[model samples]
Target: MGWFGDDSDEAEAYKQVMQRPQELSRWSNQLLGDAAAYEAGKAYEDHVAANGHPDEHHQAKEILAGVIGDFVDREVEVQGLDFIDRDWAKRHAQRRAEIELYDQHGDRW
Candidate 1:
């Protein structure tokens, strides 16, 4: 029994959710961090500093927006979402990995 359905039922609904590759909020944060790091280069920093303190934040915002936009634009590249069932995806992934390991190397020898 699980979110998708009981043990007797297939987890098709759950699998659909798992197959999607949409980036989460954390991905945006990571993109922002990376953008900020790159924009922190001396030349960029100097240019912003010349403008004013507020301009620095503005520049960082623009850079982060662009980075996030790029990532969103490429969201379609995510695949394998509908292969199984979303609710069961995590358990399926774990079980598959375990089975793979067992197949590669017997559990007791």
Candidate 2:
């Protein structure tokens, strides 16, 4: 387990999100616009062409399309912009503790 009791895949994903708040904010802003729809369409076309099995490709495309649609439609607000604030400080402390744990054990847990 991580220092923050983050042993599951969901916890790990949340940790990654906490680590890249700025990047996530930027990407979320981009995804909120029409560019993401265009890119998702192109990516789906490319994936369909690259995959060999037609049935599998279609299923995968459906799943990918749903995910892209959800991301585009969802409202994303970037919080904790102030580094000196209590919330930001707490999150930074937790992330630092996780990093220290990783440095000590190197994912052995």
Candidate 3:
């Protein structure tokens, strides 16, 4: 009979050392980024309403999230983490974006 587990499972478990500090940092960054985006977006809209729309496009949430995402990647490397689940981080960012949008506008769209 084959063994009940494989090397991949054990290696993954060992690699994840529960980075509490980094997790806290990420949470703070996400919250701040969302708040900043919401405020900046409102200012942008107000400006556009008064001065007409500009030719350039402005997406505060996406831009802020992308900047934070880059920082997360760099942090993982600096923290010497064996494995960082970028996909997981990305999912959190998407969820936060949706929530912030709804909270700011009272609409899920």
Candidate 4:
């Protein structure tokens, strides 16, 4: 069984993809254990939004990956570039509010 469109591999592929329900359920339960964790905090989001520019995290990741520089050395390496000209915080908050409402109303979010 291999990944070369072999019929013999179909069962393996099926099992691989379908085998994660238990793990997914366990992970979901663990994640949802604290209801507040899913509650995205505004101050935290704002902080990330503010400090996420010029992506120090990305730079660190690239540095770890052995890209030698204080930053990623490429034109395509722009970070924290948001195309939307509006305050994403409000939009994000609204989406979260909807999800929270769904969760509160006994519907899965």
> Which prediction has the highest lDDT against the true structure?
3
Candidate structures ordered by TM-score, highest first: 3, 2, 1, 4
Residue-by-residue lDDT tens digits, candidate 3, 7-38: 33222222232233555334343333333333
Lowest summed lDDT over 10 consecutive residues: which window, candidate 1? 1-10
lDDT of 4 by residue, 33-89 (tens): 111112222222344457752244443222222221211122012322132222232
Off by over 4 Å in 3: 1-58, 106-109
True lDDT of residue 85, candidate 2: 34
The lDDT, on a scale of 0 to 1, for candidate 2 is 0.38
How many angstroms is residue 91 displaced in model 2 relative to the true structure, after the best TM-score fit?
32
Indicate whether candidate 2 or candidate 4 has the larger TM-score: 2
On a 0 to 100 scale, what is the lDDT of residue 37 in model 1?
A: 26
Worst 10 residues of 4 by lDDT: 67-76
After superposing candidate 2 on the true structure, give the runs of residues whose Cα lies further than 4 Å from its correct spot. Answer: 1-33, 56-61, 66-109
Selected candidate, larger TM-score, 2 vs 3: 3
Q: Candidate 1, residue 87: CA error in Å?
A: 27
Model 1, stretches more than 4 Å misplaced?
1-55, 77-109
Clashing pairs in 4: none
lDDT of 2 by residue, 1-109 (tens): 2222335332444444445545534433322322323333334446546873235434644544554444333323244333223333233333343343344344444
